[model samples]
Target chain A: MQKSTQAGFWKKNQRALAPWFFMAPGIIMFLVYVIYPIFQSIGISFYEWDGLGPKTYVGLQNYRDLLDDDSFYTSLKNNVIWLVLYLLAIPAGLAVALFLNQTVAGIRLYKSLFFFPFVISQVVVGLIFTWFYAPGFGILPHVINFFTGTPTAILADDKYATYGVIAAGLWPQTAYCMILYLTGLNNISPDQVEAARMDNAKGWSMLWHIIIPQLRPATFIALVVTVIGALRSFDLISVMTVGGPFGSTRVLSYFMYEQSLSEYGTAMGYGAAIAVVLFAIMLVFISLFIVRMLSQERNA
Target chain B: MRSLKALAGLALGVSLFATAAVAGEIVLNSDQSDPAPKKAMEELIADFQKANPGITVKWNNFDHEGYKSAIRNFLTADAPDVAAWYAGNRMAPFVKAGLFEDVSDVWKDNGLDDALKSASASMTIDGKKWGVPYTYYQWGIYYNKDVYKKAGVTEPKNWAEFVANCEKFKAAGVDCLTTGDKGGWPAAGIFDYINMRTNGYEFHMDLTAGKVKWTDPKVKATFAEWAKVVPYMSANATAIDWQDAAALMAQGKAANYVMGNFAVDTFKKGGMTNDNLGFMIFPEITAGIPRAEEAPTDTFHIPSGAKNKADARKFLAFVASADAQTKMNATLGQLPVNNKATAADDPFIKTGFTELSSAYALAQFFDRDAPADMAKAGMDGFQEFITHPENIDAILERLDKVAAKVYK
Candidate 1:
């Protein structure tokens, strides 16, 4: 009787419990690596620690200092610039995908050439851009010198350093988005396009009313990745400028690492506070993305 | 019966751990991953082992970045008997955290107090020696003689002559000075020399120790002096690396570089030979301020948690000796920290030896002398000043704000 009852309970609830069993590894990993560290960083921000010496509790002092910190403001300004400028990748990517979508001789070769930047490591991209803008010897400065009679080392000027790094970041990002859109273009329903063409819809009208709506899923993924990429734009800055020309190119991610983990950095509490602020900024967008996806799921 | 057997095994393990340190064996941990430093380390180990045959060294080598993280974690958990680190304020955190052992007795017994006299102050903290400095390298103006000839200028003898030479170089279309502060610390080298020369070494010591305010008149005076040469510096210096600046000097594109002895190899690699490469002490600013020089030191320390403290002390004393340092630095291509030790017969090394020996004080460079936070902030401020000399007051104010927090 006891065996049968146990068997009956398993039979009844296994359907509900089976998915959780399948998700156990991922869920546990998320809880440990993601959720726990977020709280741990938040807790650490309330202390004065150098990762070597004893930690002293200083209750929001790190945040208070950030308010007065000029570098913090500079990093924040650069981050906003990155977010706004980085969105250009999506539309730019769409244009490229559309341009390359048509069947032609060696179309795959052209598509791969467009995809080359993203295929290479971000470090390589940064190095290429660094050489491209290097002072005196770089091609861009030489060209600028020829045209305007003033040689411009784009990475060196504080006014232009962030934009220069953003341009390097955009190369890979645009390619990534292009691949997404290309795949989306392939999956567009032929019947719907045929119907739209039958009504004499074409060009911008066809793209706006017919193609883009079909590309919504691709657009969503591109938006999410681009936003995250912009937020976590550390490698290019590290390789090209190192938050230099008087800290003009520093974003919050690089700032956090500089404060806490770089060769000269040891301010654990301050770095943690910066991390918390970055997380809060990310949380707003992440929540919006989650909400939109959930509404769409419900509609589907 | 099985549980009892397990208990017996656990007891045996505990007893073995207790006796391990006393078994005539010592473990040495270091991050001398470069070819020269690694070979020098191997030779030093062999020599130490030969001298003390009864004792053995178990060496665990690590790469540079990994060792920095390892030393901190390993010190508190399973530290080696001897570990490689740096000197001056760079080692202060470890000393303060009780991560490093106080080796005052090692200094006294080895007569290192007299032998390594130039580095004595840097190795000491709270009236106790924390480590043994083995090697250091000098910093001065490393100029291209060919560039100077091309510009029809001679090496300057004093501050006025230096400024005059800068004008001559400007006329010749050569950058008077070149430096890249992208990694940030290179600018601090320029700041240190100017500050030390303008006021004195004591002022630099106090300022870096945070006893002096950044906005003080004396600091402004230093900045004022530095402002004269800012125009002559590379306009794009804030974007490049020190190596790039060195290349500028090597290629005859720039007239001078304020750099360390290590850059000699890089210059040589760039096809600059000894005859065309010139070294000179920075010209005097305030005439009577005792001539201080920068020579950053690298050292070895024993962790407080080290198991074989006796062997570690022996290792420290051995490294501190003139013979060991001379031989080791010969391979490492750097200056021996010991006053009695002979530097390599290379012309630059010979000049560096004289420069350091004659100095009234030896600063361990700005980044090493100042706390890491202040060093980084001060260097960033220096970089800004290099680009925008007009922002001196703003930079100083920002530095003062950071100093207020850091010093507190």
Candidate 2:
């Protein structure tokens, strides 16, 4: 009777144990590299350090100082601008996906070609845009001159530098969103589409009511990625401007780097504080996303 | 339960034993981007290893931008045994924090007293030496003699003559000066020279250290004078790199490039010779203001927590020796920091050495003298003044805020 009870327990628990064994490696790596570092960085934010020697506890002073820093305000404003403008890529990508969703000869090849920019490195994209925006000899300047009889170097002009960089960032981001939507479009139910058509629910009405709801998972992922991408906009800025022309194009990431690491960046504590604030801003979005996802899961 | 506990204890003992038995390795970090300098370092490492067979040396090289960010992170964590670093106020904070090993004994043993006294002065904090000098290149005006001749101009001797030469070059359809302010410090160098010439070396040092305010009339006048020469600058100068700007002068498109002696190679690569290029000290601005020369030096420092501190000190001493400095500079086209080191065959190096020796006092490059925060503010002010030459007062005011926050 004891042997039979043991056999029954093994049969019941094997599947649960097997899944945990499969998940162990990934969970362990995530805990070590990501989760621990977040806590460690937050701990470091309260101390004044130059990345060496004893760290003095500065408490809330670093945060207080940030409030009065003009550069902080500029960076925050630019981040907001980056986020708002970066979202435009979502609808723009959807439009492109829908245009190419129909079956056509060599459509797979065409889709890949459209998706190429997202595959290249952001550093390379920055270089390409820098050349494109350079004055006199660049294609952009010539195009502007042909149309307006005057050419303005986009990057050198402080008013336009951040916008120019954002536009370059969108090139890849839009392609990424397009690929997501195309995959979503591939999985849409044709039977539902036909039934909606029979009921005279067509075009915009059908899309809004049927197509978009079905693509909700893909849309959610696209928004999440776009938001994160906009917030972490550092590579392109570093390559194109290095936060120059009077730091007009400075973002929070570059500003943090400037404070922590650059030739003049010795305030490791101040840099950590800035990073904490950035992380806090990101946390708000993450929490909202988690709540929304949980509700959706519950409803489903 | 007894078997499980025994197994866990065994595993813990093995891990602790492994940690204790970890072997030591010497790691040297450097930020020199040029292939030649890296190659020279590799050769030096091979030689050092041969001399000490039991010791192992590992070289880690980083590109310019990557190095700037990574060094700080590395220093905070497991820093390398030895690393190349900038001097001046750039190293002052690090020295003050005691992140670097005090190498005063090594300095004395190597007898680098007179040769490196100036550089040592920059590296020292509270009378403790932190690093050994490696290579320091002089900053001056590198003009294309062909461009000057084409424009019917001669190299300037003083402030008035420099302005006259600029007028002539502009009239001849040549841009009088070309610079890349993409990083912003190149323009700051010009600002430093102007301040040094106008107010003298002591005042310039005082202003950068925040002992004086940015809105001082002398500082204001320096900006005013710099603005007067803006029209003679190359169009689209802000977008170019220093190398590309040198290329412009090499091609006779621009009349002058105010840069370091390291630019000699860039010109040679462009097929320009010593005859085509000429070097001069920054044109004097006033009759009696003792000229403050801008000389950026590169040195090596041993981290306080380095595992191979003795090896690092040995390497530093070797690099500072006249023989090593001569060989490295001759190959890399940089001026040796050791004054006693034999001069190279290169004309640019010889001229730079002569100019440095004759200067009343040498100031480390402006950005290096000022704290990082202040340097950023000062560079931004210079960029703003360059773009809107009319808003001098506003620029100074913004810089004053930056100075106040940083200096206090």
Candidate 3:
């Protein structure tokens, strides 16, 4: 009887509470996992910690040290390069999606095959590229030698090391963007495209005016993910170069790892400071994205 | 109603099991994920269990690289009763933080002071023994005897003869030296040995410990000497790993590899026999400087947060025994820390034992000897020096800047 009364009350309030019930789990999760760590890392950035020892409060000293650090600047520059080059995945992905959009025999298999690099783990991708770029043994050097008459080890030269790692990162990222664009293309309103076709609109003109206008939602998501992916590119660098051939391949993420988590010794505070700097940079893009999203919502 | 009762019963069972699981057992974390070392660890645990039948030992094994990062979390959180770590400065930080337990009683009770005499100094901090070392191995130049013979050059005794032999190998169309710095530590090994040879072991220790600046003239001399030999080394070495470079040596394309004795196993696996593979001390660079070798020692420690201290101590004492060490290192293809252990019949082992026994001092390699931040910067500098030898001053200056911040 008591349980039935409770159920009755719940049913009475269900209209008002159902949406909140649905959002509660997601909100709690975001708060705990995502939102909490950002503030926590910021808090830790003010202290010097070795991850094992007692944390000592050091005020803004970590930030001051980071300002003086040359490697921090190098990592920041590489991150900018990564952010710029990583966006290339979007256009390349859209192009591939367009090329494979048509119906044909084994089209499903071809699509799956095209999506293969994304399915493989980044660690494996890094290893494959490492093997590919290894001089005197790897196939890449052979190919380069065949063309240029001199075998070049892409990963060994400091000038090319970060670019080499970036290229490896692009392989999987491009595949991911391709999949997103394929989905967006599948969901496109056929009436508009058909009407454009009847009006003699086709190729680049149709793509730029009609297809792209409808794919703005997918493009926004792709840009957001790509930017985040570029910032968080630690695995490939670690697996391939270990920030070496002289720390030339270090990104901010990899630099943070080397400072705190690596086998050498821990400087958790310094690592957190690097993380905070990276977060600040990411916040700029994120805030711009949010503002644009808000304006779009208002228009809608 | 029936399902609710069953759920309650299941919860009750799980709670009982959880209590049973935590009552009395020693949790050991180790990085003996490799085949031979894994087997050796199993045998050691079995022996320990046989000796202490009352206690339960729960072994948690991780891969070498993963364990390094995982250790920091486990030490302060859910620390194992026993954990594998490296000796010297590597363990010093943990000891200073009071994260590692002082197992001085274990050392005293088992007379490990005499047994593990060689590693005792490394395991000690603040005049207390914080860990027990079980195994260590030698690092030196491993050369192809056939390549040396083909070039008509013998084992070089001093830097001059070594350089001349390198020239001979170069003249004969063979790469003179081979090393891999893709992972960074392999190149750091070269730096460690060269620095030791250039300024003697004391200066090398002081430098790694950050008592001396990287821009010191003594450090510059080591880089200068390394620069002279860079042209003789294998081209594009940074692209290959240590195993791949050893492959070049095994194929007789490269004459020598400045590596640990472990490279012998890889050489053997690559089909180089005892007859062709030769181990030699790095030739003397600074005359009258006592020769010091890099011999990284692997150790086990009791974490301060360990739940089962008694069982952990027993494990350490048993591991420190000469009998346990001999069998462990035999499977590990490494040298036992116990001086009283029976010597292996292997030629390389014999050579390493003799060489290490006569050495004036031992360094735990560059990465192990130096703090991690400095080691990372130092190794990066070393790798940079290899490709751009002219950038020594700039690299050293950067390293000094890092050292100033890190060592402080």
lDDT of 2 by residue, A138-200 (tens): 799889888998787787777888999999999999999999999999999999999999999
* Tens-place lDDT digits, model 2, residues B63-154: 87678667766665567889888888888766777778889889889888777865767777788788887888898888889888888887
CA displacement after TM-score superposition, residue B305 of candidate 1 (Å): 2.1
Superposition error at A6 for model 1 (Å): 6.1
Q: For all the models shown, what interface RMSD does each have?
A: 1.5, 2.1, 1.3
True-structure RMSD, every candidate:
3.8, 4.6, 4.8
Which stretches of model 1 miss by more than 4 angstroms? A1-13, B1-25, B54-56
Itemize residue pairs with steric clashes in candidate 3: A264-B372
Measured with C-alpha atoms, the lDDT of residue A20 in candidate 1 is 98
Candidate rank order under TM-score = 1, 3, 2
| Candidate 2 TM-score versus the reference | 0.89
Off by over 4 Å in 3: A1-18, A187-191, A194-199, B1-25
Per-residue lDDT of candidate 3, residues B1-408 (tens digit): 699789987876665455333545789999998888899999999888888888778999998989998888778656788999999888877888889998999999999899888888888888899999999899999999999899999999898888888888999999888887777788898888888999999999999899998899999999888887899988777767889998999999999888997778899999999898999998999899999998999999999978788888988998999999999888888898899996577998888888888899988988888987788888888888888888989999999899888888
lDDT of 1 at A60: 92
Best by lDDT: 1
Best-to-worst order by DockQ is 3, 1, 2
Candidates 1 and 3 compared: the better one by DockQ is 3
